[model samples]
Target: MTQDSGVGRICQKPVSALLFDMDNTLFDLVGAQIASCQEIVRFLGYKDGEELFSYFLKPVHGFESHENIRQYMEERSIPIDGMYEKACRIYETEKLRHISPYPGVAETLKYLHDRGYPMCIVTDAHSRDATLRLEKIGLLPFFSGMVAYDMVNVKKPAPEPFLAALEMMRAPAGDALLIGDSIRRDIEPCARLGIRTVYARYGDRFAAGHQDSGADFIIDGMDELPEILDKFNKI
Candidate 1:
């Protein structure tokens, strides 16, 4: 499922550094969150996990806020004090328990790392959650630094987080490659910054259908990245 834009050779400047989106790009964070929602609902004797999951999608409370759980409970007239704390704990614990990197992620990362490509993470997650997830999956050591939502106080689709990552890695936009799942947040923003982007199509869960991603390259899996990098280097 790899597709290239076929506009031109990618080596206008050779890629010297890598930037990655930490959530679905590296692992299925949404899937883990869904599973966590299911666990929470089951523990509370609720019938529909999807109903609980819908609360996180609401814009009132941020996606990661535990306040969503409270709101969900209140709507059902469920007790809030002890139950809210317990629900939050179950959600956090189960989410982390279910997280694992996509296949070949570690190998691809090691391949890139061994070849001297400095990497940084740009994520919408808070710093603590990002650190915990990466550490849980044992990929924390691979990144030189991270620009988290808490650090930049901005999320992707904004240029600030991407700029902060490039600065942290000391890599010019043209000389760095960013791999991420969301076209709107990851691809378009990086393209505007003159950074080459690899849209992780395999990780995308939000796009409605098969919309064109507007990325320089698209990879179906992490293992395909080395080949893309090879093309960049050879050109």
Candidate 2:
């Protein structure tokens, strides 16, 4: 009943590369994001949470759809990008103070970091804030590099961003494992890239098949990762 029994080697030395999702994976983006969404919408004169989530998540599925927003803004003769970017800048600078990692994350990352694991972050979050959270929380140096939606103009569930991360690291796709919270976005895309994925079920706001998910491995905590890797050694 061991996880990763049929996949890559597990010894700490055997697995040298780890790629993580930023938003909900390494940290709890939902909580802070919702808070920021509320603040931004209120600033914009909006009062509905659903509408706010939809507005912020517009760049989630893909950026092409953002063109639609851009167009709508242009039709109204408004500076869409500048306005949102400014609002986003404000949201991010303030939000990082509230952002937090899943329980045991700090120690687990420190464990991996101390072991010399080369880690990279792949995210579909906006430009400044996503990275700032990492830096503000002192987790920034743990990563060797990152690929964000603002950088590539695409979102998760799309392989390009993760692929770019792998390429940037000069690491083969098969040599990496993507650990994240979203099945459709994080797990699915990495799987397609032939990157073995670990579905971080712990601290996930959504359930696995229970909270509406389809991840590969549903973990209960960060400490279990070493055990999972140990089993991989046998496989």
Candidate 3:
């Protein structure tokens, strides 16, 4: 069912609980990561920040960008002992400064919370990393439950993290909605378990695959979310 408002249209379903992807969905994750990487390279006295950032992510892609700094320094024969450790420290310190929630995210979350809809965060990020980001964004209180990659031996696409969140919230798969950017990681896996899927189209970074097959709904921004939930009377 589609409901058209001034802002956008929400394809509604019976949504009981919300399972959210932390990065990109809630905030500009790519922006924060790129900023941190660029600052790290500059701190290490290198002008080729963007090129090196690409190289660093090419092999071991994810949030663990600092781990590759050591290999990069060694490959270039930069002879900067302890530079890798120092770079990691710098990246960690600066990353928090660069992080914040996307516009409308905080208000939407508060609206959902006040209306008594259970919300859980299911992310393929280290617990420490996820915790820090939530704290920075002031969103820690809105989530009723969280499932982090590090908390489980398996990550997303495995269904373990999603299942964990469902269990934590005591939510049935059919009554829940999983929203995220990745088809491989979030949409497809949750769809396998019969949960409704909402593709956070604003957060799609790679643009490699289509969301058509898995997602039951698609939202371009957080502002569209409340209207979607409105069908469920969350307003």
Candidate 4:
């Protein structure tokens, strides 16, 4: 299945299944989170959204933890009786409202679905959050299953989540292609497991400087996926 088709070499086997990273890959989660943080700050009469958003980037409480909101309030000495809960609700609502699929996501997913490629989501988010985000963007129906942090109790860069997804889909690593935004979390771990990798360059927000992602292929947009798959299948 390896072919030097002028778009990097293809995988060693035809991709029978697709594994997707949910957050940044499927949609602009970082953008949504920023919007949500701004809305939260507005509700709290603050002018800086990044001040609150920084809490999520910290190692404490994790990125998706609502405790970030509590910490933000506490650092400012805001009363925590009912304000914290209201802020959490506002954050969740605004985040969901701002989330939408990237350009050509639905069409590409539909195209792959029509071509009989099974797809599953591999995410570090909780199952409930994953479902809510996917459902919000109307992409829930496209996936056959999901492997979330709750199920594996481990995040990416760890092999557990990807391995769980492969087992749930019943697809061998060589025959599966993993599309994700993070080189450390998504591409490298799956590559080690003998799975082919596609780095979604458009969705990458965390990589500060350009570095090799170690992906078998790199696509700038979801529309380019069909062509990549075509190359893989042509072998």
lDDT top scorer: 1
TM-score of each: 0.95, 0.72, 0.89, 0.93
Tens digits of lDDT, candidate 1, 1-235 = 6789764536656888899999999999888989999999998889788888888889899777899999999999998879899999999999999999999999999888888889999999999999999999999989998999999998989999999998998988999999999998999999999899999998987776866788889998999998888877862
What overall lDDT, based on C-alpha atoms, would model 1 receive against the true structure?
Answer: 0.90
Q: How accurate is candidate 3 locally (lDDT)?
A: 0.78
Query: Residue 89: error of model 2 in Å?
Result: 6.1
lDDT of 2 by residue, 100-127 (tens): 8777777888877877778888888765
- For residues 45-126, what per-residue lDDT tens digits would candidate 3 score against the true structure? 7877676667555757454656567666777776666777788887777778898888789998998898888999999788
Residue 226, candidate 4: alpha-carbon lDDT? 84
Off by over 4 Å in 1: 7-9
Report lDDT per candidate: 0.90, 0.68, 0.78, 0.88
Model 4 ranges off by over 4 Å: 1-9
Candidates sorted by TM-score, best first: 1, 4, 3, 2
Clashing pairs in 3: none
Q: Candidate 2's error at 188, in angstroms?
A: 1.1
Q: Rank the candidates by lDDT, best first.
A: 1, 4, 3, 2
- Better by lDDT, candidate 3 or 1: 1
